[model samples]
Target: MEERPNNDTTISTDEINVLLGKLKFSEEESVQIMSTNDGKNVKGFESWAVGKIMATEHPNREAMYRVFKSLWYTKEEVDFVALKEGAVIVKFGCLEDRSRILKLMPWLFDKCLFSMVPFVKGKNIASYEFGLSPFWLRVYNIPIELMDRQLVVAVGNAIGELVAIDWKDRNGAWTEFMRLKVKIDISKPLRRIVKLVSRYGGETIEVIKYERLPDFCYMCGLIGHTFKNCKDNREGAGINDSNAQYGSWMRAPFVNPNQERNMRRNGVEIVKTTITANEDKEESQTNSRDESGQSAQKGNEKEVKKARYRHHLWKKEVISLYMTAWDGLSIRGSA
Candidate 1:
């Protein structure tokens, strides 16, 4: 009978280090350096963006790309390269196409929000943050008198960066609610309601409803994941859905364009408010209600300060979550 050698073997750290020490490299191959200018000359460096699909389960990369291509309908062809942790490097044929795609952000793929940011040269793609996205909000319960563009801008700024406003319909009639686009930070809880204080010391509550909102955590109010997969819920430290701070009421009803046209043809009259920029300006100048309205101004200032504070808190929370999640991932590589 022939003797067989053991197939399994283990190498200790010291043994591996000793073997590595025995290897030698030529002077020419020992050291190499590159400058930032070298990186700039790389292909697709000028027209690229980093994106992440905000979902735990990523869709088929090919299928997702096809869907995005159709949805974007850019003038030039776009390329998508999948990266670690559901991130992708998107290459556009031109800067125009890239800017257009980014402007129409918060795109939905398989019912999940896709957040993107313009690529920064020499920055690690993994370090790019995908926490902010623009959303169209339908603000309800706003007083008819305060439905002007100035008021909308003020409230929109308090919530997030104001992008644009839907002034009126084709018939020049105001909709039931104020519609404005604002960039929101998805890392923090969604703001469901905003309180406005008038110069008369009266308060009004405005209910915020998002259009085309995807699955989000009802318990924590964060977007990208449902409560079931939330860290708080996974650890059994979160509350039940019934007692959650957010609910379906936060989602706004979708308005169909065809339906709107039908309504217009059927002679349905929507409340008309012909507000011009000049009118808004005149109103502002005439009502220079000074420090007497200090209480109301202070209220708004306090809300803005609070929003800033919440943003800082969210950054800390995100850092903690990232560290905890990274620690759990099993890494395999050679030194």
Candidate 2:
């Protein structure tokens, strides 16, 4: 007999299951998850014959191969490699297997949903997409004066594709504004150029490679796709090119006029605390080593203690800020 969840309980079984479902795939566990290859040194299809399969949870290699095996009606007919980001690269024994998978489009195996797309060889992941090329450009010590639309456009044009800026400090009401988003190419080899030559020359721009990029759909208020490709409205209220403009929040600058002053005050406090903590840590380590020869154990203990304290404080502050922001957003939404 199953006991029903009591209303007074903090978390129900369903909630626990939901959290468990979102658990990230362990790299250690996935290291040994490779499909069997029958002594073939080279890939058969190369670029034109691979499929990129995405899922919420990383599928087991044997289970993934089984999906194809069932489809192809063979015992060991498919080979696959799992990516770190829960995506899988499935190489079929023949072009016919590839075609059949593509024809089926969306796939389901062992109660897990999956999205399948073609894997183009030689070209990167960004090249397969319809919109602009994706990349993350980090500007160091950007002059607060130049953080405007003009700067965004200039830096964007300098890169291959000018998608969107990636910073948000609300200058106005918090109601409608959302986080900034940009496109990113997964396949292209990262190119990091130190100097960004603008009207303000000699500014150093750092390009860091990230596993994923910003994906927000303004049209449908979704996260995976952009507004252009959103299928939220399949009927008469379709979004097309001419009408595909930015929302009200996107059109206006996010920064409040007084944000710089507030940021300066907060930055000063955070920097001072961080510096003080670092200095204290160094002093403690030095004193520990001087007093006792075994500083390693003492140092580890101190680090763990410091990390926990900092994390607790940080979490509290974040929760406070989030609540404050949420209230503001609620008021604005009502208006």
Candidate 3:
């Protein structure tokens, strides 16, 4: 065998290269790596739609700069650029940061309202356009039994069109108790008189026009984009077209055979009238009982609960009767 060198003398090329790469020097030239886009698909620039500022006029460049400087986010966290027509484009450093800001949107900043919307991809940030957005109506106080998809769809169709129906599942499975989402037409005046009639038990479901529903896109059946800007193939009719017809249908008075049934039922007045009559008869007995040193507070509380339960039962029974009467009238109208 040839004479072998000692361990210190015989250095491995791989070990030498590794040691050289780790060496740092003050005079070394910094090599900057640049990405070249050869018309190939690359990572997208994360952005959000920022508009609906409540200021009298659009915030200027200096104002926006001051606003951002006052709020959260460092220079590296986000890139805020003012777009054409008072809109804004916010590019986040990461998706998590973007999501966090979106959750905090429609925020009240500097005593002005600023609403955030979903950004459209492949569209120039400076030229993206928006229009009068469709709104969402969250209907609470819905009875558990009447929350079927079919019933929700029927009620939603009457309002405008069923963008989506969210069901609240308590046990990770479908149940009778749920909530509903119905899209309302923004162009036409609200149809506040429409009632949903249940086919199974003939119960009249009354929905109150509580508040403006959140924006849900009918195109992609998702919540984000305001109306048809989702770029999905499915397009909804404008308020002038299909929504107008639906609005008219909803506003039409339901024809009940009895004139009393067709007219608006004064459930509160009925309850009050019945309660007053009962109170008058009970007042004399109550006075005598009070004179005899009987406790009247307990009895009065019991009477109030009874009256409330009675009023609720009476309202439900009367509404059911009206719905049944209307069904016959609807069949007659169809014939």
Candidate 4:
């Protein structure tokens, strides 16, 4: 026999033969069990009772546990339990109260959109055949696996209404999940799509439209709002352009240092170079390193000395050459 786990969450996939099934015990001991049946029995076995019975026969305890599970299929499964002929009594597993399904509208709508359903709303809902819904509305393309049982009941409990009357068809036959779909009211949420679709269809650049709208500056025709509301402008821009000369934020006098007039007045604009006002000032100061004006006086002195020296040298050289030539000719004549 297989031993049972005291913990709430777990299961085993062990196997068991027919000998263990013949034994009897309690359901609590039989949890987290795995089993393979050697044969079938007319009477059905309960969860707790089987574990106690098999514990005595099989020392392994695992064998008995496997046998119990093979015959019972004890794992929790999604299922519907019926209270009456047409209605479900149990809300666990697959059988959830009708009101629970109603509150799933938002999740359903989101799922519908995720699944790429073109439109999802509750009015005249039968056309898309969402089955039975309690909110008088619905969104399609919802994944069935996502609808949790507890959530469905919670939704019903919150709204203080039955999510739906999980009823069998008029035929009064037991309904299987494969055939079941929900019914709901679809009128309200449907309008949301009308506007969404209108904008989606009308605006060609929807990405830019949706993302850029909040950022637009009315004064500049730029994104992120106008200068009046702009945080950047308010923080020491120091000037405002109430009267826009060029109908543009740039042309206006809104403390933009790049404006032409400000640049010109401040010498920030260097016509020949891309230097700023401070850089131009620095360049001019560098050219005037001799601020005491001694450099100018020294330059004048150098010029005067060069002129006087050139005049004296030319006069001395010419006179010396003339005397040498005359002496040479006189000596030749005497000879």
Backbone collisions counted per model? 0, 5, 2, 52
Query: Relative to the unseen true structure, what is the C-alpha lDDT of residue 300 in candidate 2, on a scale of 0 to 100?
Result: 55
Residue-by-residue lDDT tens digits, candidate 1, 1-335: 99776795656556778998998979987888765664444346688899888877665667667766755666788999887667899998778778767755567665678788998887866578898888878898988787786788798889997765665433454457777778898888999999999989999999999977877988788887887888777564657556878888899874454443332221111111122323464355345546355555555445444543443443333323322322222221000
Instruction: Give TM-scores for every candidate, taking all chains together and pairing residue i with residue i.
Output: 0.65, 0.24, 0.35, 0.13
lDDT of 4: 0.27
Better of 2 and 3 by lDDT: 3
Candidate 3, which ten residues in sequence have the lowest lDDT sum? 263-272
- Candidate 2 stretches with Cα past 4 Å from truth are 1-43, 46-53, 59-61, 74-76, 125-335
Lowest lDDT 10-residue stretch of candidate 4: 47-56
Query: What is candidate 2's CA lDDT for residue 62?
Result: 61
Candidate order by TM-score, decreasing, is 1, 3, 2, 4
CA-lDDT, candidates in order: 0.68, 0.42, 0.45, 0.27
Q: Higher-TM-score candidate among 1 and 4?
A: 1
TM-score between candidate 3 and the true structure: 0.35
Better of 1 and 2 by TM-score: 1
lDDT for 176 in candidate 1 is 70
Better model by lDDT: candidate 3 vs candidate 4: 3
Q: What tens-digit string does per-residue lDDT give for candidate 3 at 163-254?
A: 43333333332353233334443333444544555557664546443222223343332323334454543454453443332222222233
Clashing residue pairs found in predicted model 2: 134-183, 134-184, 171-254, 171-255, 171-256
Q: Please name the candidate that would achieve the greatest TM-score relative to the true structure.
A: 1
RMSD of each: 13.9, 22.5, 23.0, 44.8
Candidate maximizing lDDT: 1
Per-residue C-alpha lDDT of model 2 across residues 1-335, encoded as one tens digit per residue: 99887775555456778998888869885577667965343336442243433222334556555544544442226667764334466676655556544432233343233445556655543334422233334443444555565555554454444443333333431122212222433233233332455575556553322212223454643334455565565666756556744332322223332453332111111222333457667666677787787775566556545654553454333333332332243233233
